[model samples]
Target: MNHLKALLIKFVMIAVVLIVVLTLIFDVPFMDSIWTSLVLTVLAYILGDFLLFRLAANRSSQNVRNMIATGGDIIIAFLTIWYMQVALVDANGSIALGSFIAAVIIGAGEWFFHKYLDGNVVSKNTRTTADLEADYKK
Candidate 1:
């Protein structure tokens, strides 16, 4: 089930990217083009998620990892929103708005997927617990 969710989320993300790319080919404004806004949104999300993952993986304790991951997800949500507002969004800025909406839309699904994969607690210092906690916070 967890694997399914991850794959699903990944598929959706890719689909959105493809849609945006297609729109960009027609000379759509940055605000009107789904591709540019989505690309920037994805860039922000990827960076934010990577940071959270690294923080979780490198933390000293499992509990800390959970906290970091949770915090990271929250950060991703807000930062993406900020990204949309920065006028860096193309195509009348609506596409950027859509990108922000998209992140929050799928965040819970991804978080749940991650948590399901790490539900078992092994030890405070082990990777499983840490991974689980990271999932929980998200």
Candidate 2:
């Protein structure tokens, strides 16, 4: 249930970000279909987390860990777009595959770079959200 709430929050955040981006780029009122998109996105995100993080977790390779995490995000995005279009939507707006791949790569790179800046501490077992907050308690 905790992860569910987190996933829903993630969906809302990503939905806002995507909607703002679409509005900026195409001047489309993306809100008309936002609720469905957000729900689909959240479900995808939770599924990805379960498959990539919870299932594929615990390995030696840091790259593998990061790959799993990144894969989760990509899966979430594609699932969101796919399910929204198929089950809940009727329009046919498309994203360029190459551009979408590039964005995923960029997002993964940015995530890794941020993790690196944080003392290369990518393992949640090593350091957690609460741990960081406690450390910063000054």
Which prediction has the highest TM-score against the true structure? 2
RMSD of every prediction: 8.5, 9.1
Displacement of residue 40 (Cα, Å) in model 2 is: 3.5
Error of 2 at 86 (Å): 7.0
Query: For residues 1-138, could you state the per-residue lDDT of candidate 2 as single tens digits?
Result: 545555555556555555554434434346633764466455644554444443443433446555666666666665554454344434445433322543364345434432342232234455433345556885
Candidate 2: regions farther than 4 A off: 1-5, 59-62, 82-138
The stretch of ten residues in a row with the least summed lDDT in candidate 2 is 113-122
lDDT of 1 by residue, 70-117 (tens): 456545644544454344434354545555554454454445533533
Off by over 4 Å in 1: 1-9, 13-51, 57-90, 119-138
Candidate 1, after superposition: displacement of residue 59 in Å? 9.6
